[model samples]
Target: MYAIVRTGGKQYQVATGDTLRVEKLKGEVGETVELSDVLLVADGENIRVGVPAVEGAKVVAKIVEQGKAKKVLVFKKKKRKGYRVMRGHRQMFTALSIQEIM
Candidate 1:
């Protein structure tokens, strides 16, 4: 079975044993987190979709890792005036292993 869940303002499709990185979430490695914002659930030919979210439906996941994504550089330059600016950023993320959908 597979489920569509929402976390950190983003949506993700996940199935049992699947690992994916999402926006950083609270908790340490090995901690179980329940995603209650399940948008849809599918099993073979059966499908259940929510108007906003399926009531009582949730996805259970284990936190595998907490990390940051690759740095993104932002640069700005102005001609003749000799103005320049640069910045770098790394977005934090949480790696989750889908355990079950219920």
Candidate 2:
């Protein structure tokens, strides 16, 4: 079965044993996280969709890792004006292993 879960202002379609990186979340490695905002669930030919979210439907995942993504550089320059700006950023993320959907 597969499920669509919402987290950190994003939605992800996941299935059991699948691993994916999502926006930063609390908890350490090996911690269990229950995602209750399940938007859709599908099993073979059967599908269940939520109004906003499916009641009593949830996805269980394990935090496998947490780290920052690669740095992104932002540069801006104004020709002739001798103005320039440079910045770098690394977004934090959490890796999750989907365990089950219920």
Candidate 3:
């Protein structure tokens, strides 16, 4: 079975044992996080959806790691003015493994 969960103002489609990174959450490694904003659940041909979120549906995940993403560079230049700007940024994220969906 698979489920669509909402976390950190984002939605994700996940299944049991799936590992993925999401926006930074408040927890340490090996911590259990219960994602309660389940938007949809699917099993074979049967599907359950919610108006905003599925009631009584939740996904359990375990934080495996926490880190930042690869650095991204932002460059800006003004032609004929010799003006230039460069910046780099790395977004923080947490890796979680889906343990169960209920």
Candidate 4:
């Protein structure tokens, strides 16, 4: 079965054994987290969509990694003014392994 769940202010389509990275979540690796904001679920030919979220539907996942993504550079300059600014940032993320959809 597959499920559409919301967590960390984002939505993800997931199925059992699938892994994905999302906004950083609390807790350590190997910890289990339940995504209760399930927007949809599909099992074979059966599909269900929620009005906001499905009650009693949830996606369980395990935290696999907590890390930062690759750095992104931001540069700004003004023509003929010799004014320039540069900045770099790395967004934190959490890798999750979907265990089950219930």
Candidate 5:
């Protein structure tokens, strides 16, 4: 079975054993988290959609790790007056493994 869930102001399509990176979650590695905002679920030929969220529907996950992604460089330059600017950013993300959907 697979499900669509919302967490951290975002939506994701997930199934059992699927690992995904989402906006940084406040937890340590090996922590268990429950996503209650399940919008949709599909099991073979049956599809269930929630008006807001299905009653008793939940997605369980395990936090694999907490890490930052590769740095993204941002640069700005001006031709005439010789102005230059450079910035680098590494976005924080949490890795989660979808364990089960219930």
Candidate 6:
């Protein structure tokens, strides 16, 4: 079975044992987190979709890692003005291992 769940303002399709990185979530490694915003669930030929979200549907996941993504550099310059700016950023993320869908 697979489920579509929303977390950190984004949606992800997950199945048991699948791992994915999302916006950083609160908790340490090995902590279980329940994603309650399930948009859809599919079991073989059976499908269930939600009106905004499926009531009582949830995805169980374990926090495997909490880390930052690759740095993104931002650079700006003005021609003939000798004005330049540079910045770098790393987005935080949480790695989750899908345990089950219910």
Model 4 lDDT, full chain set: 0.94
RMSD vs true structure, all candidates: 0.9, 0.7, 0.8, 0.8, 1.3, 0.8
Per-residue C-alpha lDDT of model 2 across residues 1-102, encoded as one tens digit per residue: 999999999999999999999999999999999999999999999999999999899999999999999999999999999999999999999999999999
Which candidate number has the best TM-score? Answer: 2
Candidate 4 off by > 4 Å: none
lDDT per residue for candidate 1 within 24-56, as digits (tens), equals: 999999999999999999999999999999988
TM-score of each: 0.95, 0.97, 0.96, 0.96, 0.91, 0.96
Runs in model 5 deviating more than 4 A are none
Clashes of each: 0, 0, 0, 0, 0, 0
lDDT of 1 at 63: 98
The predicted structure with the larger lDDT, 3 or 4, is 3
lDDT of 6 by residue, 9-80 (tens): 989999999999999999999999999999999999999999999998999999999999999999999999
For model 2, the local distance difference test gives 0.97
Worst 10 residues of 4 by lDDT: 3-12
User: Between which residue pairs do clashes occur in model 4?
Assistant: none
> Which pairs, if any, clash in model 2?
none
What's the residue-level lDDT of 2 in candidate 4?
Answer: 94
RMSD of 1: 0.9
C-alpha lDDT of all candidate models, in order = 0.97, 0.97, 0.97, 0.94, 0.94, 0.96
Model 6 scores worst on lDDT over the 10 consecutive residues at: 4-13
